[model samples]
Target: MTAIAEHKPAPPKPGTGGGDGGFIDLVLRFRELTILAALIVLVAVTTAVNPRFLSAQGVEDIFLNASILVLLAVGQTLVVVTRNIDLSVGSTVGLVAFVVGDFVTNSDHGLVVAVALGVGIGAVCGLVNGLLVSFCGVPALVVTLGTLYVIQGLNHYIAHGEQISAAEVPQSILDLGNGAILGVPYLPLISVVVMLLVGYYLRAYSSGREFYAIGSSPEAARLAGVPIRRRVLTAYLASGVLAGLAGTLWLARFGTVIADPAKGWELKVVAAVVVGGVAIVGGVGTVYGAALGALLITTIGSVLVVLKINSFWQEAIVGLLLLLAISADRLVALRLARVLRKRNARHG
Candidate 1:
């Protein structure tokens, strides 16, 4: 009289070409898809509310408005992909931007040189951040936070209550920012080119993927001889350079500069990156997605305008979107942890 034992189902395992893994991949892609859908819906709703919202000029304004954030978002994507953050980007942009007034109005340098100076200054700030974080073994958040204050202090000290006015700015440069080529604003076009190039690198290069590896598992990445420090430093440097570049463009677009220009943009850029679906935990998002995230944020503001939402509610909406993104990231982490545990159980 033998008793038959019941067979138990196998535990689901991630990376086994199984349904669970496929679902995770879908989740990763879902963020981008959601952004696209939201963009379409926002545009549709806004256009319905105000048909002029879809006007060609209005569309151009949206893209140009998003360009700076998009640049910062891409740079942030690089850093975040490696489990790092650069809180100094906004301050860096501000500091470099203060220089734009000097260059545009005081210096003999043309637009190109002005832009180069901004980038170089940004790189220096980045170098300070990178060296400290990599060689000093400081936590990235703390290091960036420290740099943020240092840079902001420097900005205020240098400005000493000075401001860069539109009359002092070159009309040529301002026109460059506003001018469209084949119907696309220059700023957005520049951003589009940058996003495409960065996206390609991340998608196609082995070294680019190293950023993800480091973020996915720093210990494992170190063991694999992935040169984690170098990658992380490079990420921060890239962030600085982009932020600086954005600063130059910012001056061009606005024709005005103050000591604290872009002072609050650091949070916005980080929010854009995270909301764009680049995992704050690192190694799971794209520059295009980040750019889309920037576009979505910008669109939200426009949507509010079209719908005549209270100005007070704008900040709340952005904050709520950011919170939602953070929550989504946390949920993704929990899902991954559960999958990893199941995989372990299957093996055990």
Candidate 2:
């Protein structure tokens, strides 16, 4: 009888059904699960200390407070996943909020007009940053940092130290921000909708996968014919558009706008994204994880107040969590790489 030849199956691609793909999916899910567990434990401990911490209203408040940050964090994830950053987002939010708020306050523009104006302004800002970083060859960090200051300065110049008060905001806008359906607040509901939509797109589309590929290895992605400039521009634009929407929501939620309404918020958004398991060096993360990170961070602040802990401790705790997340991500990446190498060797 002729000798039979054995044929081994080829290794699965990075995002396919088996091998590296499965392992990566597991790790990503685990990161989100870890954050969810921490959130649960935190709520349990806080509720134990103060039962009111878990009250219906208190729970609603937590979601409500996290809504804006969650939106910002989701936006940031798009850019970070592409190995880029937008430090101007906070300034963008502040500028959009003030400009939109002022326009609505002074004009008879309806909600649609207000929203469009906000989004348009944000897109313009994103366009500027994208052009500089993607086409002009400027570093993302440097471009966004420069735009951050420029936007802040423009906001200050326009505001002239003026502020938009609750009395000036339209009741309709306020309702959109504060009203609810089925006992859930509108702010949180809107945020959740956006998060779900984005998460789906990123997971289900080829373009979405390209973002990860570009972040993972830019040279490889380029070699594979991915449109690097277009994708990066799209990421920045998405982030800007979301920041604009968040600004509109901010105005509605607070019925107030100042020149520096979202000052220093960019750092918090970065922290949330990092803590949510997004690798700082880029290429791995999800909007779901980023949203959970925002919620967890927001909850921590609330917990500290409810537990009567020093406000100062809140920053320290967040910093510690940030460090832990970075270290964990680094270790996990190294280990996963090693495992994959070993597995491939054995297969060979």
Clashes of each: 0, 0
Q: Write the per-residue lDDT of candidate 1 for residues 174-219, one digit (tens) a residue.
A: 8777887887688988888988888887667767777777777677
* Clashing residue pairs for model 1: none
lDDT by residue for model 2 over 282-347, one digit each (tens)?
A: 778888889999999999999999988898898898899899988987887777789889989999
User: Model 2 — TM-score against the truth?
Assistant: 0.92
Q: Which candidate comes out best when scored by lDDT?
A: 2
Clashing pairs in 2: none
| TM-score for all models, in order of appearance | 0.91, 0.92
Q: Whole-model lDDT, candidate 2?
A: 0.86
Clash count, candidate 2 = 0
